[model samples]
Target chain A: MAVNDMTKLTLGPIAYHWSADTRRDFYARIADEAPVDEVYLGEVICSKRAPFHEADLPETIDRLERAGKTVILSTLAEVMLKRERKATEDLAAMETPEIEINNAAGLFARGKRPHRIGPFMNAYNEATIRWMAGQGATHICLPGELPADAIAVAAKAARELGLGVEVQVFGRASLAVSARCYHARAHDRTKDNCQFVCEADADGMPLRTTDNSPILRVNGIQTQSESYVALLPETGELIANNISHLRLMPQAVDMVAVATVFRDVLDRARAVDDADAMLRSVCRTTPFSNGFYHGKAGYRRIAMASPA
Target chain B: MSLAELICPAGTPAALRTAVDAGADAVYCGFQDATNARNFPGLNFTPDELAEAVVYAHAKDAKVLLALNTYPPAGKVDLWRQAADTGTRLGVDAFIVADMGVADYIARTHPQVRLHLSVQAAASSPEAIRYYCESFGVKRVVLPRILTIPEIRQIRREIPCEIETFIFGNHGLMVEGRCSLTNYLTGQSTNMDGICSPASEVDYARHDDGSMSSRLAGFTIDCFGADEMAGYPTICKGRYTAPHRPEAYYAFEEPVSLNLSRLLPQMIDAGIHAFKIEGRQRSKSYVRNVVSAFRAAVDDIRAGRTANIADLVALTEGQKQTQGAFETKKWR
Candidate 1:
């Protein structure tokens, strides 16, 4: 097991507002067909999204667990309100699904209980990872802004501390989160009276410059990259650096098919070129970018060197 | 505890002296390297300059807090460590840090130095603030601009650390320490590289329509009208068009600065200990004007008199201001 020959695939927490049926259906399909080893459920972006899917959570968890998927609950990404604090505490007290600490509030609420640190918590270096490990962090999904060299160093440091290092492999990269909802504000509504307009844009509303160039995607309070980040070509490099997990953030796409492509590539059953082709076919709206890992503009897609 | 302290910014030694002479209770600054957030050219101070500034400020009964806030990559933490060592030897009153690694380095190496949680850490809730106080012995936390006065009171009641809130200057709506918009555009991050909208990559051009467009790394951030005053292209304040809304608008935030002068009394009543003015990249005159205005306002509040806000309007960004989330009545 220590050999780490194959890295595991994890579905990170959803940061958008999806309807109850849509979420239930999405998780159902993922539970039935996705080859992901673990699935994180719950809201990480806004607390408002919690009520919409709170009712369907148990059924969704049951379905995912029945399929032998390791289901983990994710805490809020930015906890400020009193209700948010209580909600985080309640999430930490849950007995079944493990908790992923997206905000530092979760770390404090969860105390020394074993948990997974989400990318939003700013696990940038060895000291943070080591500190989280001391506080009973078993896994850490580092921030997506890290380049390949930073990722390698963090992965090595995490391994030394006996923790799993998970990096986001595919999805519209998150750029920022604000207290005020840009999605609501854009629709001529305040954050309080948003009326859940974000649900309309399944993948998030595309924001472009005056020249109509796709620049960013706005999901309620969160800002994301217009281009989806695909790391199918960099799996070999990630594995070589001892990365234990690859996180595929849930997007409004055929995620099951997306997971199969990653699973096949990791299993050595499909070539990287074929997988990349399959990914392009599934990803329709946004261009593919791997620039963050390359230490360049996040929207730039660097052509990987042909498989070594 | 008697009155809220006036923490001001000092981009240079002149600004430092200006702020201190203007009745600043403390001055926060950083080194010129990428170890600090304001890594702009011709800004910040060297070790020797900082030592001199500290001596000058201490003579005026003002404190100097060194900002080693930017997160260093795993193997590249030495620069931050070295900054902390230099800051300690220079006799800085406190270290404003965001990354846990930086805080840990400061805590373990120089346990006596006071540690303040930078807004970049985005520790908004009480539990989050408690985590830092429990882990790194952080003495103060600079609250993000997102919180309300009531929220601050609630956190102050729940947490053990002292609280500092930005009273004026850039009103960043984005959650601090978490934003990557600058990195997405310029391949640089405010948290990681200590730069946002790096001035080197910023360009301004006049459109064919006779409007001015501010660009960040070749991407148009915001286009200003003929009569409009164009502010620096902070990515968050940029106007952009979305698929749902074709017309360009300030989708995230408008080009306005925060002036919490009206709510100074409420903030003080909320147990806010330090009132930080955010603009380390600004000038000595701007520093003197803002610090003097806020200093007068704080004194007036203590003497139970009217604290005027109109006197500071000329210094606000784009000549516009907002109470921000502190006075925000909107629900989220």
Candidate 2:
């Protein structure tokens, strides 16, 4: 496989809760300063929060586009409500930019509209990738939990099918999404009156086992691994697999610095040493891990220190 | 209306015959590989066993549905493709598929075989189901266990396929076909490996306080008192303490079986084409008892008599039962 200088960096849509201003400012700064190739902007979490930033989406999209970034409108992770369906349909109808479908509802609504298949769509193999490409998908983000061998196979298939492949490069991996909101249920409130308590933690709350070992993170309805999925050490394998893009999900702190480190690693490959030092400087919470890429237990940490 | 079909799970060849003799209208089983969700060792049939089981079911005037539900790991599509071919060659009635690639493979190559979208696919809406039907020629869809009766009725009016629902057995409140929490904890998933808390990783220890703790991969999933029965240690059914909750509670769902015997007539009236019993990991006696009870209830409902089905509650999870996402969403 040939590595291309056009290595794309995609800013995956925020998977955690943030206040309206915080979200607005994060994207505005991403638009102006971040060295990203594409920006996926929309509410991928609870539908109740969408209305908070719904009015500002157009301005954000415009600003990101004016800053020489390709903007892809994103859809919700799960679509069960009437308003959610309408929101996905409205996003599919937007003519300004392409859409990245996170669920089957979004894929159905797009219906051959030439969209990007988000990681949540479950395209793990060559056959599924070919099917999605045949359905007019131009880019396919492989599922976050898939092993590296699978990623290589999928990247090969994507190259043959003439589509782009993107992998999560940083941030807490989204483990699962559910219809029931544990946050609201924990607070003794129904899903209807959740009081938007998930916004208190800009990132999700750390979930530890009864033994007090950090194991997971709980957002509104989505559960994520506590270990931040860092793919910086596997840059060589990713390049060998013909992966065209790497996705970085938005976190609460030092996001621009995070993007800059990835940019340095992608640009100067071998010149960028000390993966641990880079991660320690940029990460605000949780230790960095790349075990998912090595096909080991995702929670296990692989030694990335260069041969001393 | 025609005779209501009773679909039962068969983990092995002996279980398949047991379910058939118990008067199951159809028996669903999986191959001994990752292609099926019930990928337990000592359970599920080999290719030769499945061929013989299908012949046995056909002789008994019953059908066999082969579960090829797992999403094929990348570079291993050949295994799933071969499983589809083997099922079709053995004359299985339908292929219950969860992956788009598997569905497409069966739809294109073995067009003669019937395709039933497994609940794992998580196609919850009319549009999503309709897309599968229009694209892949799916004949039936195993509806997810999270819909209300009214929701199922509304969906039936929209899609062009038969609907098979879980009438009794393990009821998963979480979205089917999308959960990997089990694999996260125990390194095996029902969707990928067909085993949730595989027997190798599970252990039961009696605590000093007379409570039994069931652990999976060194993590305590649940603990039950002396009188309370210890259910299987699945991630979803495990008790945990959240931030706001003071004590340990079921953060996801309580361990409860879904007994919709009381709602059979309502489901039938709502246009359900089949009623499914969900214990592939159970004993032969359980298969015989549950199938016979449901068979009698369906016949009684057809004969216009008051159907009674309360004795089966003892077999439910936690020794209690609930209508589960059927009556209303307020149970949450």
- For each candidate, give the interface RMSD after superposing the true interface residues on Cα: 1.3, 1.9
Candidate models: Cα lDDT each = 0.88, 0.81
Query: TM-score of chain B, candidate 1?
Result: 0.96
Error of 1 at B249 (Å): 1.0
CA lDDT of A209 in candidate 2? 51
- The TM-score that candidate 1 achieves is 0.97
- Clashes counted in candidate 2 amount to 3
Best by lDDT: 1
Superposed Cα deviation of residue B269, candidate 1 (Å)? 2.6
Candidate 1's C-alpha lDDT? 0.88
Per-residue C-alpha lDDT of model 1 across residues B209-261, encoded as one tens digit per residue: 78898899999998898888766888888889987678899888777788888
lDDT of 1 at A106: 86
lDDT of 1 at B270: 77
lDDT of 2: 0.81
Q: What is the fnat score of candidate 2?
A: 0.32
Candidate 2 lDDT, A108-190, residue by residue in tens: 77788789988878887899999889888998998876777888898899989999999998888877777777677667775
Compared with the true structure, what per-residue lDDT tens digits does model 2 show for residues B34-93?
999888888899899998999999999999999999888689899999999989999999
Summarize candidate 1's per-residue lDDT along A218-306 as a digit string, tens digits.
Answer: 99989999999999999989988978999999898999999999998888888889889999999875799999999998889999877
